[model samples]
Target: MVLTNVEEQMSLRLAVEDFLFEESALLDDGRFREWLDLVTEDVRYVIPVQTTRERAHGSAGSTTMAHWDDDYIGLEMRILRLDTEYAWAEDPPSRLRHFVSNVRVRPGSEPDEYEVRSNVMVSRGRGDSRATDLLTAERQDVLRRTDQGFRLARRTVVLDHVVIATHNLAFFF
Candidate 1:
């Protein structure tokens, strides 16, 4: 049976939400290798540094300055580092919880691609620490349809705070 336009849109939204939720779960579970599989070979994952600017200025984030600018290879390398003893940041491993909300999905320039926007809040608690750090951001993503499912092609995370208060940014968003 053929679905109506509204039904199709609803179905697509649910699929996108499911994909994002799964990704979050993987990160929360420290399953970096499995998360990597959800991304495309040419994936570009970036987190631009947010700046406090006047209303006259166009964007708050700098195109050049980024907390993270990674391709598939870079991401793979980072994940590999986590496995080694040299990864001091994650020696004890941080407990992470990702809260994703306000997901919006739309068609992309490519037929098999979709543009998705969402808000994310990550809570991190390190070993023997009572303090839990909270990081909030807006994420813009390009998901490409593949035989397996939707794969992340591109992602840009814009942080809410201009000055980050977290101890370290060793976790993913």
Candidate 2:
């Protein structure tokens, strides 16, 4: 059966949502290597540092320094390190729940690509700790359709808080 443009778009949206859900599940499950596979070889994962200034200062985020600026190779190394026993920050490993919502997907300028924006809240519980660290942010992603499936080509995370409350970033956003 032939699908209309609207129908096709709806299907695409559903596909994108499913892709995000799967990615989140992988991270929450501590499947870092598998999660890295979802990213393209030339993927760029960036988390810009946020600042607070008067209204006259204009934008709050700065390009000078990024909390995280990783290419595929860098990301792969990080994932590999996290999986090793030497990684003290996650040696015991923390329980993480990634909540992704407000997902909005639009066709990108590039062919077979989509620009997606979503709100993410990561709740992490350390071993025997009564407290849970909550990190909130908005992520802008570029997803490209590949032979395997949709792969993340770029991700820009904009954290909500000016001063991050978490002691350390042991979990993915």
Candidate whose TM-score is highest: 1
TM-score of 1: 0.97
lDDT of 2 by residue, 1-173 (tens): 23369988788889999999999999999999999999999999999899997999898898898888999999988888986788898878989999999998888878878899999999998889899988999999999999999999999999998898877775677
**Model 2, C-alpha of 164: deviation from truth (Å):** 1.0
TM-score of each: 0.97, 0.94
Give the best candidate by lDDT: 1
Local accuracy of candidate 1 as per-residue lDDT tens digits, 59-138: 89988899999999999999999999999999899999999999999899888999999999999999998999999999
Residue 133 in candidate 1, Cα distance off native in Å = 0.4
Model 1 lDDT, full chain set: 0.94
What's model 2's lDDT at 25?
A: 99
Q: Give the runs in model 2 whose Cα sits over 4 Å from its true position.
A: 1-4
